[model samples]
Target: MNEQIVITFGNEKILTELKAAHPDRDLMMYQALSQPGEFMLLDHSGKDSVFKAPVFYDILSHSGEDKWDGFISFSTLDLNFDQQKVFDARINKLRTNGLPDGMHSIYSLNYHKDISQRIILGTWDDYADFELWKNSSDEFIPKEYRDSPNFYSHEAYYTPAKTKKTQ
Candidate 1:
């Protein structure tokens, strides 16, 4: 039973309950049909139900194994990007600008689903280069993150999940 738990629109009961529980905290819960195990969390800090979902996420664990091999998707904008750059160059950038098989479509591996343990890390494929991704210099599939030792990366940080569930 090695399945990762996620929030879904069909869980309206949970959603409504979550919404009612933290009315003061903003929430943007929705269902994205394109990706199944996917859930949208737009600035969802105080209102992340994944922390309170079930036994699965309640004791969340992360692996730096081979399957985490996806892009850190992000929209092509300077808004959060620049701030993120200021924050650190190596943080997982999971969102996208909607291009043909682009980063926006590669959300599975880039964000943190920090569950019970309170911290999960998202590492990029070593070839991660914003300038390269946006440029027409060359088009090619990227190698694994372990390919280059010189690859720039962000220092690991701890993000505490909501240990208390209203439900």
Candidate 2:
């Protein structure tokens, strides 16, 4: 399936390194309008295309993908250090135990700080699948992670209607 991914870097140094590492990859790089020095790299390509770049796994703290024209969702969680560890462990468990049903692709990013932001980007096979994953209870997620009062989560969903190509 054709895929769309968004990766954000906090500085030019990392961005430069990414460009140097993936000279042949097709990427749309732009500075964040609101956050100076922060760059966002967008790529739309075949399945698992982004995995070819070593820097994607190395420097990128935030990354997510959606199938072209399909359902995509993003969530940002703010958590403390202990909560972050629990969250990471839960994510690892989910990875090893298999993702919730209908999840096509999922990405977890932790922007470490006092109240770190843990962002999750996920795509589903269809709207129904997306709904299924969204409405699922704490059974799908770890209990401590779910019950944690020290964290806050915000989520948004998107469906692309058209694509604009710019030269």
Candidate 3:
């Protein structure tokens, strides 16, 4: 799975500033409203991601980060306050608990400009199982979204979650 940043934005001013800051970023900003707002930035300049899925390793794969810079995009609306806190703690927990450290990062894109979320730029490695991420063609289903999932619930987000065994 190619790693891309997910941002949720319904605010015009904040979204505009963000767009201006990183016009080159491979960003997927979400809009709750019916109309997609205009972007006041330059055209996309980076190579399109070569994202794929790992079917056999469905549960083992990661999407946030792998061997390179990557981001997990999502909406806060999907999670309640407690779930949000749990997610925040778990993501940080991943930085220290597992064999690999600093492998992924979770970012929320909201309409509130008061929140300080910056755009990150660098090479990103796909984290999710290639097959599993690819087989996710059911975007319209109640649970799935093309790439902008309202909430990112994966096996890696919690302990006891396993991964490919390196030899």
Candidate whose TM-score is highest:
2
Pitting candidate 1 against candidate 2, the one with the higher TM-score is 2
For model 2, residues 34-136, the per-residue Cα lDDT tens digits are 3454554445332244433322221122223434335556577777777667777766666666666667666665443223766666666666786776677
TM-score quality measure for candidate 3: 0.27
Highest lDDT: give the candidate number: 2
Off by over 4 Å in 2: 1-41, 44-69, 112-115, 139-150, 164-167
Candidate 3: segments with Cα more than 4 A from true spot = 1-77, 98-123, 127-167
Tell me each candidate's TM-score. Answer: 0.28, 0.54, 0.27
lDDT of 3 at 98: 43
Best of the two (2, 3) by TM-score = 2
TM match of model 1 to true structure: 0.28
What is the Cα-based lDDT of residue 138 in candidate 1?
23
Q: List the global CA lDDT of all models.
A: 0.32, 0.53, 0.31
Q: Sort every candidate by lDDT, greatest first.
A: 2, 1, 3
- lDDT at 10, model 2: 38
Write down the worst ten-residue block by lDDT for model 2. 54-63
